[model samples]
Target: MWYNIDFYIWAVNLLVIRLRKPKMIAFVKSLVTPIVNIHYDFLQKKAIDEFILNHNGQVCYLRKALNDVFDNELRRIRIGSGNQYNRQYIYTRAEQKPVYLGKIYIRDKSAFADTGIDYIVYVPKKILASRELELIKWIEIFNEAGTAYKIIGE
Candidate 1:
């Protein structure tokens, strides 16, 4: 009876450890990277503020732009879920279709190929286009909605 109890305890402990691993990893990842750290406060603030103002504080524009450019591709890739971390948002479109978006770190190339972000909008080009002004306005709306944004480049 004692031996059975000991084995049961050990099994329970192992199960607990296993269940905690993913949460621990996610926590560690969050701590290692400062989500809001900005090297140039002024620049970051201005960019963020401008984006908010330009977008008139709407988050839908980002989704719209993404859908417009990559909805079909996402469907093709079969990535149908998304994970959010700070200012970074990842979308996986793997339900009936397959498309993965955002910074995906996959160990297997085949898996990546099977499910990857179909379309990527070039920031600079989007910024330079005639529609830039409109895009900025939309981004500003998102800001007003209290959404944090991360500018990839200076």
Candidate 2:
């Protein structure tokens, strides 16, 4: 009788596993891979405009060569988990994958709040709805705001 009961339980477990959907795994795989084809000329123009406006129309070292801004800052620094504050809005996603993933941290200003200076702008295995929109917003912020970033888990 005990052997029969054990077999019954095993059969039920197998059925459940087979019936389970694979949405979660699909989401993870998508996040793990990102599309890297795109143009940045428009963004470069926007970044330059933003810098000049923010700096009172002054062309400083970085402002003069704004195209280098993304290459210099975005590819540098370090990516954070965005878990320091346990904020739910920080998790990110890509609409059609991304060129990269990482966090953005302020280059200057010592002792700034961790959350304020570092934003988990991009990552794989994103959660929460509307994360796609959030990712786009944060990437723009990281690129245009003069913040530096680096990949952590990648």
Question: Which runs of model 2 end up more than 4 angstroms from their true locations?
Answer: 1-116, 125-142
lDDT of 1 by residue, 17-101 (tens): 6565666656544553443233245456776666444443223455554334334344221112222222323445554443445
Q: Model 2 over residues 88-152: C-alpha lDDT tens digits?
A: 23334664555353665544332234644443432333221324454344344435355543322
Worst 10 residues of 1 by lDDT: 76-85
Give each model's whole-structure lDDT.
0.39, 0.39
